[model samples]
Target: MPGPPTIFVARQPIFDRRAAVHGYELLFRGSAENRFTGGDVESASAINIEQSTAAFGLDALVGERLAFVNLSRGALLQEFYRMLPSERTVIELLESVHGDAEVLEACRELKRRGYRLALDDFTDAPHSQPLLAYADIVKVDLRQTPEALTPGFTSRLRGKRLSLVAEKVETPQEHRRAMAAGYDLFQGYYFCQPEMIETRDLAPSQLSQMRFLAEVSRSEVSFEQLEELFRRDVAMTLRLLRYLNSAAFGWRHEIRSVGHALMLMGVRPLRKWAMMMGFLRLAGDKPHELAITALTRARFAEQLGPPAGLEHHDSELFLTGILSTAEAMLGRSLRDVLTALAVPDMVRTALLDGGSRLGAVLRIVMAYERGDWPTVESVRTECAVDERALTDAYVSSLQWAETSAAA
Candidate 1:
């Protein structure tokens, strides 16, 4: 039996300060090896739907989280309902699924099992009309649908008592238009902006020293352990303080102790700078494409769910992503760095295996850098970080780097 080839889904919550997120629409993302096309359910059926649903169960659907997943006609015919607990998962009968009696009956039977149903990008269908009563939410894709006819279509569907969600609201203006049109839920980039920016290298040796500094920042090593790291690393310690105390950070007093400095700078912030340094550390001092993913993933992970694992006292996720491609950075296998720094097991799992969930997320970041839209998804189910927060991080990194240069 073949296993599910790792289809990660990241949800975008539709909420505001005025209202809590009532629901999240499940979006599918593929791995580095696979690209999930927006359409083509036939191609999707070639993978194991049962195992794929299990991965989704692991990544999402734990709590009261409600997600919308597109169901191909093939999945329904195969009795895929056994794979997911109907109570936790909602089946969005796809628009592409031809509205035959058997297909509609399958949807109706699934709904009878207490599953929430959605009509995917579909508002009206004579054959699927029976399934409409089962729909709890209606997704209105403002991006693809004609703007002029939206009001009329939305009005026609208003009486269904289903919540109208404006999917793919890409700008503030788009959000405003949707909200004004009485959209109960919203998704997209109105509140956040992605920077059209690029990163440059400072120098190679300086980068290595910064990584050494990052090791110090997130390290849980005792004072003696830290001092031991400093034995042959004196110059790195001095440069770290210089960068930390510079005018941009605006340290009013000269911070003298490493521990005190660590407390003030914070591990995430330090790791971010160290990532920039890591990119510059070798390969003739040119900004490489691979470094871009590491930086983006580190920046994105810092904004996500709680940081619990601190292998060797560092934020585990940051190292998981920042040092994911360590072999390339140092011109050796990750095994070399792992052996040298005494990194923890979890970090090892993420860097070398690419099998752990964190490893999966790291791959998403790489896909994102390469503009592989299908691969950059959240298999974590709930998203603590979305496009908005990431866009903000990118813009902020630029401003912070500029300030660092000035100081």
Candidate 2:
């Protein structure tokens, strides 16, 4: 059966002056097929965000930190802020929302209800002045405005009590400029970029775990070998037992042995679960979205395999999708990471080169992820898959990722 609608929720962290994470700006989108319909972008985005938050809960996306959500004029008029927790949600008024009487009245009402409000993509204009009365924070787009004019614009707001947020601060120089201009909050890719580390050697424990993962990924994995490997790692053994005993598995009896656990889960699911754990451990201090993306890709590729005429090799396709992001997660090339894990030749070749069937599935998954529909369509046609199957795979992958992440 088809699963839930495909919803993508990404959080961009907002940092205070001391470089502490103060909150996150929650970005959300609906399924790739329904994303762009030439409608009002802000309203559509607002609806998607509202639906996603309802389905997944706000804490799943932003943890305990404040969530800044963009509200279109329509959403503001609907009093959407009333539905969210006032203390934890910051209603960001989109730049497209003119500071007219209705919007201002709505903003005033929201403030009266104890909800904090922010002005998104703030620019010094005559029309924006009225919003200042209700705005607790104002975000200025560094990329859209000239550096020479930023100081002048920000200085004019010095008398106001609102905190200034500098958006799109993409470089060290821009960060410094924002700091100099007395901006209290910062957001952008500058903070999330992966820091390249020269040493690529896995820790001794991680090496052992990878070896076990490689064994499980084999076409013919032995139960005895998995039992022996689990026996060596006390934490893994306990985790497996706990997972087996959990309500999700609905085991009637307590799992007392590693072999028993392996028998219950079977080699296929065990391999996928272990690989996910290993990759997440290797991710270290990387952003949470990295794990989400990897798992989503893995599931998407696996589901797409049957439709793409590679049903017999779905596991290999899944591995290819997961390993495609290894370079970003491990700060090393895909070849090096795969070699370290001793992945299958087909999976390695698919990731390193772009000719294999698994490679084609990976390409389609990636293009679909980026909403590059034309490229996705071309690859889908080449693989002889229809749009419905592809959309179902994508949506199901998203649902699996969300559920797995919560687990």
Candidate 3:
């Protein structure tokens, strides 16, 4: 069967004074591979937001936590903000939104309907003051606003009964400054940076599992080839048999040998299973999210393969996704990890440089994950996949990851 279409959504956490997660600002990219054109921003934002909410549902995107969604001036005027639950939804108006009569009326209506409003990238300009009357929160871009101006900015708004949100808080010092400046909330990458850890040599078992994964990823494999590798580790042998006989598979007869399991589970399923198992075994003390990310990327790439004219080489695409994060997950450079795993030149080129079709798709996946909607749109146009296909693939990948993590 063909894989799912690609759709991408990313959430940036918002923190309160105590440094606890208060809510998330959900960012949407319409297509997994496409960039937004210089067309109507309101229409594009609305389309992407609607597509994402339809695919994942609002609860799946933000869980029980509150969610902040950006509303273009057009969306606000049209009352699209009313679609979401008011108690947990914060309707964010862009700074570019003019405080015209229509917009101000929309803001008043939204507040009257019990929807909290935020002004994104707030600047204390004369144009923004009119909207401030309805804004419950104001986000100041620390990167763009000078430190000297921040105190006066907050001081001026002190009587407005609005919460101050310090956006683009990129450092510990900036976080402290924002707090001192009377900001009530914070948002940025200061707290999400990965800790650098010393790289270590792989254990014998891990090395074996790596080799086993490499073998599974190959184009052709025989029962003897799989059985020989399975016999080297008793645990792997049991895992294979158990998976094949599990209720999910529902085979008519019980499997008795590794060969039987291999025959029952086709090459594609076997390869995915082996790859997932290998990653689980190798991810020692690593964050569980890394595994989830790798698996999701793998499924996403595989789903994109056929549409990109790589129908016969989906396994390679899957491996490309899985190995893309090896550096971060293993605390080693990608070049070194790929060299050790003996990945093909095509996969290597895709990872090192965006030179091939697979490389283009991989780039799209990475950009989408980071919420880089423009890059995603450009890459999607370059790769020639439609928005619906890409969005479906991404949503399917998320569903797959959720199921795999639970399993």
lDDT of each model, Cα atoms only? 0.52, 0.70, 0.70
Instruction: Give Cα distance to truth, residue 147, candidate 2, Å.
Output: 4.5
Clashing pairs in 2: none
> Candidate 3's residue-wise lDDT over 1-407, tens digit each?
64344456667789899989898887655444323335555554554344334334565566677888888876675464544667878988987898989899988899998989999998867888899889998888987778523677788776788888888888899898888889899888896521111111112245456556545554455678678767776656654554444332345596777877778777655554443345533664342466578768888888888888788877678888878877775677878777766567889999988789999989989988889999999998988878899999999997886555433
TM-score, every prediction: 0.40, 0.46, 0.46
Which residue segments of model 3 deviate by more than 4 Å? Answer: 31-39, 147-149, 193-407
Q: Candidates ranked by TM-score, best first?
A: 3, 2, 1
TM-score for candidate 1, please give it: 0.40
Better of 1 and 2 by lDDT: 2
lDDT, candidate 1, 96-154, per-residue tens:
77667777777677767677777766546566566666677777677567751357777
Error of model 2, residue 182, in angstroms: 0.7
Residue-level lDDT tens digits of model 2 in 1-407: 65323445456789998999998886644333412335454445444443334334565556678888877775576454444567778889888888999888888888998899999998877798889988999898888878522667777776787888889889988899889888888987788631111111112255455555545644467788778777776656655665465433446696667898889877655644544455435655442476578768888998888888899986687667767777776677767777666567888778888777888998998899999999998999999998998888899898876555433
- Scored against the true structure, residue 209 in model 3 reaches a CA lDDT of 61
